[model samples]
Target: MADPHERNGENERKPDSTDDANLSARLKSLDARISQASAQRAEAEPRPRSKTDSSAIGQAFRYSAEFVSGVIAGGIVGWLVDRLFGISPWGLIICLILGFCAGMLNLLRASGTIKPARYDDKK
Candidate 1:
């Protein structure tokens, strides 16, 4: 005679093909939604700008500040060094020259007179 538990187990078993098809359809739907979300995110993100993006007026103001600060700092240092070392006129004269050079250097750097180094593809 057939056992009652064996008969119940056969009745409870579900078809494997239906489960596989359902899972495949759910996965495909999820993949499509992910692709759409990614595209939207890309469109919402901001693009990077170049370093030399300032207007002419802004550039001029920056250069002016750089030049003035460099000259004042250099001159003060030179004067202090001269006074501290007891070099009177000689210290003052040397410091003035150094200050002028520093001012010019600052102006050149601000105006991009010196070219930036180029990166090589090697390495």
Candidate 2:
């Protein structure tokens, strides 16, 4: 008598439900692990969500530094001028005011409130 699963000399392979179920379970487990890793990585490395936020913070620091440096440099130069030329308070006052204006202009440029002359001229 011939076996029901045999066709000529070759044996036919019958599909197993358990094999399909195991493969599906393994695939689902891999997907879960990948999702968990991605979540962990995201949590571990927090980043600025927007370019504007990062640049704004940088600009704030830069403007503050520029303003302070201008004031200090002006004070030093004014003091030097007064000592060398014997003009006293007037030299310090005028130079300090000029420095303040220069600082304000720098801040405006940094904030994009004013257009750059050189850049505008180039266009």
Which candidate number maximizes TM-score?
A: 2
TM-score of 1: 0.47
Q: What is the lDDT of residue 111 in candidate 2?
A: 65
Quote each prediction's TM-score. 0.47, 0.52
Top-lDDT structure, candidate number: 2
For residues 13-122, what per-residue lDDT tens digits would candidate 1 score against the true structure?
Answer: 65699899999999999999999999999999997554574677887888888778777777788789878998877877777777778777878876778743453567
lDDT values, one for every candidate: 0.78, 0.84
Q: Model 2 misses residue 123 by how many Å?
A: 3.5
Residue 34 of model 2 has an lDDT of 100
Task: Return the clash pairs for model 2, or none.
Answer: none
| lDDT for 54 (candidate 2) | 70
Write the residue-wise lDDT of candidate 2 on 28-120 in tens digits: 999999999999999999785554647767868888987878887788889999999999998899889888888888778766679864675
